[model samples]
Target: MSGLNLKALRKAFGPTEIISGVDLEIADGELIVFVGPSGCGKSTLLRLIAGLESVSAGEILIGGRDVTRVDPARRGVAMVFQSYALFPHMTVRQNMGFGMRVNRVPKAEAAERLQKAAALLQLTELLDRKPAQLSGGQRQRVAIGRAIVRDPQVFLFDEPLSNLDAELRVQMRAELAALHARLGATMIYVTHDQVEAMTLADRIVVLRAGRVEQVGAPLHLYDDPDNLFVAGFLGSPRMNFLTAEVQPDGQLRPLGLDVDLPSPIAGLRPGRRVVIGCRPEHVEIGDGPLAATVKTVEQLGNSTFVHADCAGTPIAAELQERWGTRADAALRLALPTEKTQLFDAETGLRIRQ
Candidate 1:
């Protein structure tokens, strides 16, 4: 297996930049996911590594070899695209071995490799079936099996499961995770789905508008983010942000709700404007100073989420059980003093503790 090293990677299209300077390292056998919203350049960066796109500036090193200028086929990598890209006329067995045949690999060796890949992907029985005869998940497995037969140094996936329905996506994600453990091959997957990134990545690289925002383990980024964007983007239901101001007495008032500070931040001195972030799970229904009128309540059997408006600012709280609150009802919730996160209102960057 080979690791990937990208140094100062950049790509531009006629005067417009799509990928800014990006430097990343993927360890051997590690699954690294590039996650961000659309137009964020995650897919572009993956293409650069796969040698499908040329770099405007900087270098790409695979297994310590400079492959920035190498052709896609010679870069020791195989990519699985969002589309299955399978041949409709060919059987699964033939499609999986097509790459090997084109490269002039011996027929016996190619057959053996195809057989092993089919067994690993649980597609041995489907080898005789054409693309139209297979299910969506089976077709995706065939695409992956095709890549596996290449025996590439690194694997590149560009939203390979995006076409499947929600349930199938979940099933395929688990299968891909198990496959990684079995093969121990270095893989870089790109997706706009944060849930996929959190569950599948050994480490996540968050990007925004072609530049890296933050990179860390899933929970690390969720627990402590570099800025408002990373904090709000990583979590489900999103983190809540409210405008606040630091008083002369060094007290923080967010929508008139007093919150204690953990420590003094450089830009958070007395009278500085700041934003307070609270996770829905961190809020609790209790007797507190903050009050709101319920706007909506969602009961999902095991849990409930209450959406409310406090002095025109929206706040949400998640509870283990249903609260049965009606619209326009009054409710008071307490914010965990320690769990609240503060960000500089001007720069939107977190105030490190």
Candidate 2:
């Protein structure tokens, strides 16, 4: 029953609006991610839900009860921030149990809660260590452990892994996913990283300019996006957009490559201009209608990324095996008819059949 519901949520800082007209529902035990570029209000929305900021309008409900005006401490949730926020002088055990101690929770209860959280987070071995003695990952674990000890109905993470190194971020992501599975507690996470959003969330809320651009399961949004912003934003290395125009026969000529539109875009007619989107992995490097000159090649052991120029538009193609093409080499590219996406040139919306 610890689900979250936002009804026409809005937030304004004095005269300027930050979060505008958002409506969403997060089911109990779901790990939902709020992802976007910096200043997109993802963090602000998380704060609004956590009761850290006053709502300009609308209502916030958690576990079926309204808590718009409730104090953050009174809400049945715990938050972990980007900063570890650990007490430098305190041991891991002490820091984890501090909240309960301040609330005058009995000594035995606090100790038990701390013990359980530490065990869950694999911090039992480091309980005696101080923040100064621990690495970034360990400090983060302590922070998360502190939140877990509270036994809140929901957990909020505000880019908790951003401070960690690349290797540690991957480790923490796996750990957090495991923790979510084990606890089955409702969680809301905010991050500007799309990879984290795709790998960590059961559903992702993509934000832009203080508004939600789209929300859905990660792959659903990746495979079939609602508009150009989402299609370009959700994928790594980004989806490619090449200039295209609808032919008199209803086929599309995208970067001089002819392809039939998907079944969903049946309404598009001749003489209309559109953008053709193809993910890097979808474009085949072989003989086809389009020709490109490789401008750069990225070799990453298991795969290769070819950056090229087709006419004037930049194109990126990914290959699973090793590629021998070097800079300035000529290559033919093919866009599979079934794998391409069409968007209206004027509105920047996916043109569906």
Weakest lDDT window of 10 consecutive positions for candidate 1: 258-267
TM-score of candidate 2 to 2 decimals = 0.96
Global lDDT of each model?
A: 0.91, 0.90
Alpha-carbon shift of residue 9 in model 2 (angstroms): 0.5
Worst lDDT 10-window in candidate 2 = 255-264
**lDDT tens string, model 2, 1-353?**
29999999999999999999999999999999999999999999999989988999999999998999999998898999999999999999899999998889899888888889999999999999999999999999999999999999889999999999999999999999999999999999999999999999999999998898899999999999989999999887799898777777766766455454432256567788899889999989988668889999999989999999988788899999988776999998877768888888889988876
Which clashing pairs does model 2 show? 264-352, 264-353, 265-352, 265-353, 266-353
Q: Model 1 scores what on Cα lDDT?
A: 0.91
Q: In model 1, which regions exceed 4 Å deviation?
A: 255-267
Residue 6, model 1, lDDT: 92
Residue pairs with colliding backbones in model 1 are none
